[model samples]
Structures are given as C-alpha cells and as structure tokens.
Target: MVLALGGLAVLALWGLDAVRIQPNRIVSGTGHGLIEALGTGPALLVMLPLALVMALAWRPTRGREALMLMLVTAMLAAMPWALSLFIGQFIDDPGGAARAAVSGASWLVGFALILMLIDLRQRLQPGALVTLVLIAVSLGSLGVAFGRGALDSLALVQEYEVRRAAFAEAIVNHLILVGVAVGASLVLALGLALWMRRVAGVRQGVLGVLSFIQTIPSLALFGLLLAPLAWLASRFPLLSDLGIQGIGWAPALLALVGYSLLPMTRNTFIALDGVDPDVIEAARGMGLAPLQVFFQVRLPLALPLLIEGIRITTVQAIGLAAVAALIGAGGLGTFIFQGLGQAAMNLVMLGALPIVLMAMLVDALLKALADAARRGDADDRTG
Candidate 1:
C-alpha cells in the first residue's frame, strides 16, 4: 500500500517525462513530462486506472490477482504507445535532428511499475511468474524495436551505435576477466579452505592474509600489481606476447582475484568446518575411507555454501570489472568513463545499467543453484 501510494504520488505530483529530447548528440536538452509528452488525455487514461488498481491491491480480495495482472498488462500495453507518442512529437519539430533520451521521471515510473509487478509475482506460482516474465520481455523487446529510431536518437544509444564493435568486445572481455578471476579464486580458495580445516595454525594465517588483502582498496590493489607485472613483462618477451601487460588485463585480473579470495575462502572454510562431526563419524563407520568420507560426505554437505561463496564472488567481480576499464582493460566501464568525460548522463547509464543487470542475473542464477542444493540436502536428511 505504501509503495503503491508513493508511486501514485510520483505519477501525479512529479513530472513524468519518459525521455528527453536533444537537438543533437552534443546538446543536453529538456524532456517532456508524461502528461506533456503524451498529452493529458492519454496520460490520464493510463495513470488514473493504474492508480486505482494499485490502491485496490492493498485489500485482500478474490480479484486481487486479477487486478494486479490487469495493472501489469495495462502498463505493458501502454509502454509502446507511450514511447511512440513521445517519439512522434519530435518527428515534426523544427530541429533537423533530435535525440530522445530516457528521463529520470520515466525511470522512476518504470522502476515503480517493475517493483509492483515483482511484488505481485510473489503471490503467483513459479510457472505463472515465469510466463509473465517471458511475456513482458517479449513485449518490451517489441516496444524497444518499434522505438529503435527514437532510441538511436538518444545520446547513450548513439554512443553505443558509434562503438558497437567496442561494446561487443568490452562485454566479452568483461566476462572473460570475471570468469577467470572467479574460477581461479574458487579453485585456490577451496584448496586453502580444505587445508585450513585440518590445520588450525595455518587457518588463522591464511585467513588473516586474505582479510588484509580484502581491506586494501580495489584501485590500490590494481596499482600495487603494476610494478611486478611490468617487470615480468619486460623480462620475458613471451609474457608480453601473451598480453601480460602491466596496465591491462593482467593487473586487473590479479586485482579481481585478490578481492575475490576473502569471500571464497571464508565461506568455504566455514562451510567445511561447520559440517556435522556425527555425520562424518557415521560415514566412517559405513566403511568409507578418509578420502571418500571427505569427498562424498563433507563436500556434498558443504556444496551449497560453497556455491553461495561463488555467487558472492561472481557478483562482486562483475561490478569490479567495470573499474578495470580505467587501466585499459576495456569493459562497460569504458562507456562510463567516456560518458563522464563528455558530461553525458545517458551514456553513463548505458554502461552502468548493464553491469547492474548482469550482477542481478548472476546472483539470481546462483541463488537458485544454492537453493536447489540446500533442498537436496534437506531431502537426504529426511530420507
């Protein structure tokens, strides 16, 4: 109710401009509010019914689901039309060329609508939510495609258009950096964690070192790796040929691995150590050797938490990879830095939004894996 009311208030009191229009790529200009952009008739037509549905959703009733679905459907239906109307206005403008960029108000409304739909999905079955999401994605894709011309007019889209190849390459480079760093960190951390479980003295030392590394800021860590990497590259032409430059991927990757080690190691250590001693004893009594007990019992029991560590590490690395762009290791952060340099907010969002979405998507996937593993563990115990 509170959220719905807040959204309603925003829609009513705040300017609801979906996107800004600029005369050219270089200029930043004002956008039209929802009412202004779409005209009072269309804007009110959507807003009034949306507000009503939201308010009614607060009460428990048989029709609540229906109402929620109706609201979502309405928003989805209106999206393309709203975008078309906004774009159509600029078509006849005296300006020879104009750019259309998403506005803050538009973002606010879109976020509000998405949040409401997500909340509503909580009441739905998993299959239903999945269907809803697929439908939404399909419609949203169509809407964006229909409005592609308007989108291209946006400064951010223009930036993407100009550097499409770089953008694609950046995504690949970012994924490679994250994948290698997280994968390496997980392998090393698991080994350290398993060793630490058996040796108390080494546990503290290893953990302390990793914790200290985590305390070092990411930029400082990147800076710290520069000298040794530079020396290695200088001493070995082979290393240089393999792209082990001081300022590019090598230091960035090393820094990401360093940052990832703490969470990966800590979670793994805790998960392994926390395994039930009674369970281990039972496994041993079943004639299992020490290796079998450790691998078949301890590791399986700890798998979920280990996966959780991977999840945390992967999400963290994705965000940090953006910063890697600063050192010539290109990723979405290239667009971000370029946007900042050009004072283009939309361009910054172009880079930042993908990073955010990637993190969210990865987190969701790993979370599902962890949940499944946990459920399997529970079923095993019950059986």
Candidate 2:
C-alpha cells in the first residue's frame, strides 16, 4: 500500500509539471521562499517522527507504532510540494500565480503533516521507520537546497557569494546577545538574592527598586542608559569607545539584563523566605554556619521556585530583545524593522518567525530545567 501511494505520488508530480507548474514566492518575489522551503522542509520532516515518537513515551501508545503513522501522514503532506514543483517545472508560461498557489499548498501540506502526526500519535500507534524517513527526507532536502540560495528569503546568492558568512554571523550575534543577557541575569540575580537575604533591610529595599525598573518601558530604559554610560565613557577612553556602539548590543543587553533582574530576584527571595524555619534551625544545631545553613538547607528546598523565575525572565527577555534592534542591536529584529521600513510583509514574516521559534525554544528549555530541578528536589527530600 505504501509503495502504491509513493508510485502514485511520483506520477502525479510528473503530470503536474507537464501542465506548467510554478513555485511560490511568499518570502521573496525572487525565489527566496523556494530556497527556504527547500532548506527547512526536510528538517521539519525528520523532526516529525522524532516528536511523535517522544510523545508516545508520555502516552499509552507504543513509540514505534506511533512513529509509523506519523511518517505516513508527513509523506502525504509533502506530496503537494512535490506535485507543485512538478507542475511549475512542466507548466507552459507559469506565472507568479502558480508560485503563490504552490506556496500556499506547501504550507497546507506541512501543517497537515504536523497535525496528523501529533493527533495520531496521541490516539493510536505508528512505526519508528516512518518518523526516521520523514526526518531524513526533510534534512536531505534542506542540505541540497540551502547553499543555492533556496534556503533564504533573500535571493542575492547568485550575485553575492557572502550569504553563508552573513547567515553564520547573524546566528552568532543572536546567540551572543541571548546568552550574555540570560547568563548575566542569572548570576547577578542569584548573587544579589543570596546577599540580600543576609542583610536585614536590603532585600525589601532592593526588591522595590528592581520592581520599579521593571515597570519602565524597554525603549525608555535603553534611552536612559545613554547618559550614564556616555558619561562613564567620557571619564575612561576605553569606556567611551565602547559606548560609541551606542544603541546596539551593549545598551540593549544592559536593558534586557536589568529587566530580567526583577523576576529572578523576586522569585529567589520568595522561595528562600518560604523555606521552613525548622530546616534552618536544624542546620544551625548541626553546627553549620549561617551561609552553610542557607546554602545547604534552605536553597536546595527553595530551588524549584527560583528556577521558575529564571524561566519566566528568560522568555520575557527574548521578547524585549526585539526592541533592542531600535538601538542598532542587530538581531532577527533587523529583518522586522527593515520590513516595516520598506513595507515588505515577507521580510517582516521572516524576521518575526525566527524570533517566535527562538523564544519558544528558550522557554521550553528553561521549563524542562525547572521541572528537573523540582523532581530532583523531591527525590532528595524523600531520600
């Protein structure tokens, strides 16, 4: 049955192309969407089976069975893209309309594949090979199509040979901004929370200040940094050179880090405060110093809530980082702002889409970390 379907799909593709099929230009009028579709389509396919298989572990279904069904569903969804390409290749006098239709059809196919894989995995069994094939096909296509400029929304690849470098650079910049902002926030927040807990009035006073900072809009915060940072820059030649980058990564990062402090600090303080006095007193009785008692006794018990705060702060910061582009912080936001300036919806979509994916990924990772912390704490308490 699978063989029959595959044969039919191939025949259908050939027939469609014979009729003058065309590709869509959703992201770029100059074949950029086609490149992206070619590059990313396979990745999605491979991921389909993996996601389905993992989901099965959490449900009543067997993993292998769930995977097979998902693969079948994904293959069917991919059919439209194949058929559309065939039609575009063979069609007589194919126009932009053909490309648009193909693009729309491809989106539908992708969406359907995902929905079926997820839905079937939850309700019934699928095969492991199915998922594996989906992943292979998607990833293979991506590799084959990526370097030719089909993986991008911009089609200057033929004219400019520097796109690979540009893409790599963009990826690096985004990683650095997100990494520095989130990492610094975590370290500072934790250290401040620990020290504030030791000080009698410092916790309340500091928390209030952080809360106030949180209320200030991100744009205003970035603007506000210019004066002090600039003044410092003037006082120190090295600092002045750094401030010349101005509204870019530095100011944006500073703003994001500052914004993240409130949630993390608040969560840490609350978690520490909620720790049982009995545990602290016992630790003291055991001859542990105040620092040791707080670290060994209270912190372990309070870690789960503290982690939850970190998760929230990280997600919030990702969204706020988009605004940093206003200050010359180059990120996915560059695409968005550029699109807005040029009145290009496709550019906006390209920029906005990646940011959404990045945010979701960060949120998921942090949530998983928090869950692990909670589970570990539970195990330790029980043991």
Candidate 3:
C-alpha cells in the first residue's frame, strides 16, 4: 500500500498539472507540472520522501513502518509549502485577482500522501499520542501556511479572504448544530433505551419507528417537519419569538435528531443489555449495593460501546449539519450551495475542505477514545 500510494504521488507530482494561472477566477487556465511550477532542482527535491517511502515499503520492519509514518506525515506537512513555494516564486499577484489555482497533480499528491499516512498508521498501530502529534504537525503546518499568507495566491484561500467572517460563522454554526443534535439525541436515546428495557412491549415499536425515520431521505424529513413546526410557531407566538419557525434551525435540528435516534438508541440498548451477568453478580457478591453494581460495574463495562454510538452519531451529524443550511440554518453548507449556484469551485472548496477535515478529526478522536476504553476494559478483565 505504501509503495503503491507513494508511486502514485510521485507520478502525479511529476506527470500531471501542479498549478494553473487563472487570469481571473471563472476562466480555465493553462496547466503546469511540478517541474514548471517549482523548477527542476526543487521539484526533484520534493520527490525524495516519496522515493524513500517506496524503498522502505520494499522491506517491512517495525522501525521501518514507524519511519514511513513520519515520512508520510512530513510529506503531508510539506504539501502546503510545496504550493506556497510555487506561488511565491512563479506567480506575480500584484492585484491578487490573478489566481494560482492548485491544479490536478498537486491535489492528487496531497490525497495520495494522506492515504499513505492512513495506511502506514494502520500498519504501525502507533499509540494515540503519536498519532495525534503527527496530526498536529500536519495541521500546524497548514496553519503556518495560512498565517504567513503563503497560500494567498491560491484560489481557495482567496475565496476564504472574501468571506472570512462568514467562514468563521459557518464553522461555529456547523459545529454547534452537530454538537447540539448529537447531545440531544443522546439524552433522548438514553431515556428511550432505559424505558424499552423496563417495558419490553415498547422495544419493537420504538425501534421500528426509529428504523422508519432512517428510511426517510434527509431532505424529505426536513420537508415533513416544515409544516408542523411552522403551524405551531403561528399558533403559539411564543414559539415564533423563540425562533421555532419552519424554515430554520428548528426543523433542521428536528431532522438531525430524528435521523440520529436509531443508532444512538440501538447502541445504548445493546451496551447496557450486553453487560455480563456474571460480572454484575460478582459485584453483588462483594457486598456492593445494587445501585453501586449497576453504576460502577455495568456502566464501566458498557462505556466503550456507548462511546461507539456517540462516534457514529457525531460523525453523521457533522455531515448532515451542512444540509441544514438549506433551511437558512447557516453553516458551511451555505457556501457549498452558493458556490454550486455561482459555478465557483474555489468557493465550494472553502466550505467543503473544512468539513471534510472536521469529520476526520472527530472520527479519529472518538475512535481513539473508544479504543482506550476497550483497553481499560481488557486490563480490568485480566487484572
């Protein structure tokens, strides 16, 4: 996997278009390969890590896998600089409207490097701390790139400059929407799961309803809630004053929570119910109170799976929150839809790239937490 992905990165950097000089944002510009973008000496210099990666992949060792991880992560870190170098040297952007778009090859190189990082990390099975430091290095490098205005000539960065305030607002809104939805659904799912456990008759019906909700398309769900919410807001002016209108966050929040319920409830139910009776009995045998056994023993045992449900719900909410923009809910998706409407690809990237990064970040963080929980559980079992 390392060899294949590294080779692809090398091929893309050397063979495909690395940059384009757009006279303006709308018109297509002529493509230039890495050699043309950064010249012979620098372009060849950039390929060295990829070559090392290919060589290292030829011989597998614990040390070599770890080395490959650093190299791949360095490659990711250097990506911003690679573009910045080309932009700083090759493009003369006095007015800044002349866009130096990161064309096909550079983008592919970044993608390939990320894949190599993912592949290498899986092979190495590095601890969470190591993984997080590498991620920080990559992200920090990008932050530096932006802070220094190294990406100023780049089209996407330019778009961000135009809507910096909106971009910030979008990110905050997007996270808040996802966070609120996931949190609310978690509380609701927990209650429902407990109720279902106590009242067996409701299990099938509750699950069935949640399953049905899952089948409805997100857009349709949004539409379905629109009228009822609008009516309530009209009937009760208090609801209207509180911003519970049809075509805003109220409906979007409802739709997101609705879509989230099944996974959350199912996982919560499974986690609590799947606790070993023997373990619970052991706690009881220790002269612990029933509440203590349930809270201290069963809950701890069930935590990893409960966390798994949260991971699922949070990731799903991040993506769906983008769609909430359609109802004037205001998120990164607003830029996406507007960019599509205006035929501005850079503007779309402004909205999309952050979202993709956010999803990956949340997924990785939650997965790490779940893994830690599982490890703690295993240690307890053996000890």
Better of 1 and 3 by TM-score: 3
| Displacement of the residue 195 alpha carbon in candidate 3, Å | 1.2
Q: Per-residue alpha-carbon lDDT of model 3 for 201-314, expressed as tens digits?
A: 999999999999999988888888999999999999999999999999999999999999999999999999999899888899999998898789988999999999999999
Q: Cα RMSD for candidate 3?
A: 2.4
Point out where model 2 deviates above 4 Å: 1-162, 199-204, 227-236, 243-245
Per-model TM against the reference: 0.89, 0.66, 0.91
- lDDT of the candidates, in the order given: 0.79, 0.63, 0.89
lDDT of 1: 0.79
Sort by lDDT, top down from the best: 3, 1, 2
2 against 3, candidate with superior lDDT:
3
Of candidates 3 and 1, the better by lDDT: 3
Q: Candidate 3, residue 312: CA error in Å?
A: 0.3
| Backbone atom clashes (below 3 Å) for every candidate | 1, 32, 0
RMSD of each: 2.9, 8.6, 2.4
RMSD of 2: 8.6
